[model samples]
Target: MIFAIETAALQTFDGAFADELFLVARILFGGVIAFIGLNHFLNLEEMAGYAEYKGAPAPTLSVGASGVVLVLGGLAVALGAFPTLAAGALAGFLVVATPMMHDFWAVPEDQRQDELNSFLKNVGLLGMTVLLLAVSTVEWPYAVGVGLV
Candidate 1:
């Protein structure tokens, strides 16, 4: 497996080195999630306005609720707590939000590229979330699960 190969190749370093690397990766990833999620709160009014412009019903409430998900999911992911659920929640959030918020096809030519890029970035994040779901072995904190921090 690719992991096996990488681990074997990196055997020159202490095993803890690899663990620390992964830990850092998770922490950084989680930090990013937390940042964006927290941003939603910091710009609640503007975000809600934009959501309203996008035709999201009850934009204020929607933004508030989604922000909560992002913060919680990001925290859980960062801590490797219930990772599958956390990552899955993140993936699901991105999937629904990306299309609704980044409809590049609906934008003008000038804005299309930017929107498209946002959409693509969300896709990449979604892929990472799914990958986390697939590869993580930490157990669920509140229920049966698998994955390690």
Candidate 2:
């Protein structure tokens, strides 16, 4: 009985630490995503030009709309509000944009490496969003408690 109690106490301590770490992860991860979104606005002309070059219809509008989605979704993830939706939105954006924007195979040889790197990075972000989705249904410790499932 005493051993069991001691084990439980240790588990509680470890769980608290892990929970705090999760919060940190959310902050850093979401912050990067939000910053990327902001960059879309900051470099609007350049980004839109690239999008146009890639044959995106209404390139400027597409970039602006994506920027809004990224900023909102990233902020929600960071704030732990509407976690499932936020993660889902982020995942969806990645799924659509990664392939459309970073078609490394179709790019010229000179640009292929850069595009490949960008593609790989987006893939990594997508994986993280999926991970968040997997956990978003659960109550996150220290969350703002505004989640829908």
Candidate 3:
């Protein structure tokens, strides 16, 4: 009984540590997204230019929509208010934005390497967000299930 208690205590501590790390990462990533989104909103012209460079239609509208998605997604991720949904949304957005906006494949060979790095980073972020969604949902199924009860 005593041994079992000790083991359980250790597990609890480990779980808490893991949760803290997750929270830190989530907040940092979410904050970055939020900042970028705000920049897009604040500098519509600049974002529109970027949109044009990406060959997107209605540059201003595209920029504004992306900005809104980023802001909302970031807020959701930061709060962990609906971790699964938020993370999934972020993952999808990253997937679309990375290839559409970044365009790693179109760069010069030398610059392609750097662009690829950015692309991969965004891909990794998407993966991480997806994993976060899965893990958070699985770990707290009850919370994500009915209501938070």
Between 1 and 2, whose TM-score is larger?
A: 2
Better of 2 and 3 by lDDT: 2
Best by lDDT: 2
Best by TM-score: 2
Q: For residues 66-117, what per-residue lDDT tens digits would candidate 1 score against the true structure?
A: 8988898888777877787788889889988999999999988999999999
Estimate candidate 1's alpha-carbon lDDT, on a 0 to 1 scale. 0.78
Model 1 regions more than 4 Å off: 1-16, 138-149
- Candidate 1's TM-score reads 0.79
Query: Which ten contiguous residues of candidate 3 have the minimum total lDDT?
Result: 140-149
Clashes of each: 5, 0, 0
TM-score of every model versus the real structure? 0.79, 0.88, 0.75
**Per-model C-alpha lDDT, please?**
0.78, 0.89, 0.74
